[model samples]
Structure formats: C-alpha cells, structure tokens
Target: GTYPLYDITASPLTSGTHKFDGPEKNNPYRVLGIDEKQNYARFRFSGERNKRKLNVEFLGIKGEKLGEWSISENDLKTPKQ
Candidate 1:
C-alpha cells in the first residue's frame, strides 16, 4: 500500500527532526482516522498519544521516508467533531 509523506518536525506538534529508523517494509503507523474537508489522512505513531492527529497528504509513495515534514497543531485540529 501507498501512503502520503509528511514532516512532523516543522509544525507546532513537534520541535525536532523525526525519522523512521526502522525497516521501511514495516507499517508501524496505524490509520487512526481521516478528514474529508481538509483532504488529510490521520495516522497514530507507535507509543504516542492516540488523540494526537498527524494530518498529511499523498505526496507520492515509496518504500522509504519521503522527506522531512512537520504538521502544526492548527493543521491537525478540526473546527468541530
């Protein structure tokens, strides 16, 4: 399967660089939810908050880390449930 790539360090959600240092074949991320209005996919990181949403877009796909990207709290936050 193919998923979007997003930088989790350039946004307010994080303050440093985050790289997936494990095997690229392993899908460590679980699809938590999705936002249609924003066209973003939410993924939950291993050992992270279940509610912490990481909104990202489909910027092509590969078997490696696409690039460095950080999503801001604002970008992940929705107006209402």
Candidate 2:
C-alpha cells in the first residue's frame, strides 16, 4: 500500500484545512483542520478497502522526529468523545 506525500516544511504554522488524494485514485484523505494553539489536528480517511497501517510522526522544527505512533483500523472506527 502507498500513502500520499504531504510536505508542510515551508508552510506557516497556522490552523488550516487540507485535502489530498489517497494512494488509490478516487480515494481522498481530508484534513479537517489543524489547531496550532491547541496542538491538535483532525483528519478523515475515505478508503474503506485500505488495510494499510497508519503511522503518525511528530517532527520538530529541525526535522528531528519527536515521537511516532501507529493507528490501527479498529482505532479509527472508535467514536470521538
């Protein structure tokens, strides 16, 4: 499975929404929004048949990885509080 490439290095650290096409054509991943002040981000994946693992990484300004985690499909199905 493949994932879309998103580079935000040059972008300002401001809250905003984004959209990107998934690896498969017609499938899209929507970034609902990012709250810089709250340090939170929300996204939606619209690929039902995609069984690939979703790995998230947090990087510092210098591009050093601060932390990382993997989100399973089951986790995505859980309702938000």
Candidate 3:
C-alpha cells in the first residue's frame, strides 16, 4: 500500500503528528494535510504539493511500519478527492 512521505532524513520515523507531502511534482508519491495529529500522515500523488523525499518508514494503522519506500511525492499531478 502507499504511505505518506516524511523528511526522515532529519530523524527516524516515529509515531506522532508530523507534516508529510510531495518533495516536488513528478516525483511518484504525496502526503496530504499539515494538520496532523495521528501517528501516521496520509499522502498521495494527485496534484497536492511539491515533491519530497520519502525515504522513510511506512507506519501502519497500529503505528507499526509496514515497509519503506525511496520515492518522491510527485508521482501525480491532481487531487484524489
């Protein structure tokens, strides 16, 4: 499954509210919303924000990492909504 992209280059993936989005368009992934409070953030391509580095852990619903991806948040160029 797709996961949110966070700038984990600063720190490891942790369970907390954080910002996740595209690093730049044409990347390959995206994170939506900045008003994060849950453990994991939601992201997608669908034209949202700039492309971002997603070399982070993909946290699951239980705050557990499902896997990891080294893609950008610019896979799409439009909102899914």
**lDDT top scorer:** 3
Worst 10 residues of 1 by lDDT: 32-41
Ranking by lDDT: 3, 2, 1
TM-score of each: 0.19, 0.33, 0.22
Q: Tell how far residue 70 is off in model 2, in angstroms.
A: 1.5
Model 1, position 44: C-alpha lDDT score: 37
Judging by lDDT, tell me the better candidate of 2 and 3: 3
Looking at candidate 1, what is the lDDT of residue 73?
Answer: 47
Better of 1 and 2 by TM-score: 2
Q: Model 3 segments beyond 4 Å from truth?
A: 1-53, 71-81
Q: Residues 25-60, candidate 1, lDDT per residue (tens digit)?
A: 254662322212122223434334544444443221
CA displacement after TM-score superposition, residue 38 of candidate 1 (Å): 23
The TM-score that candidate 1 achieves is 0.19
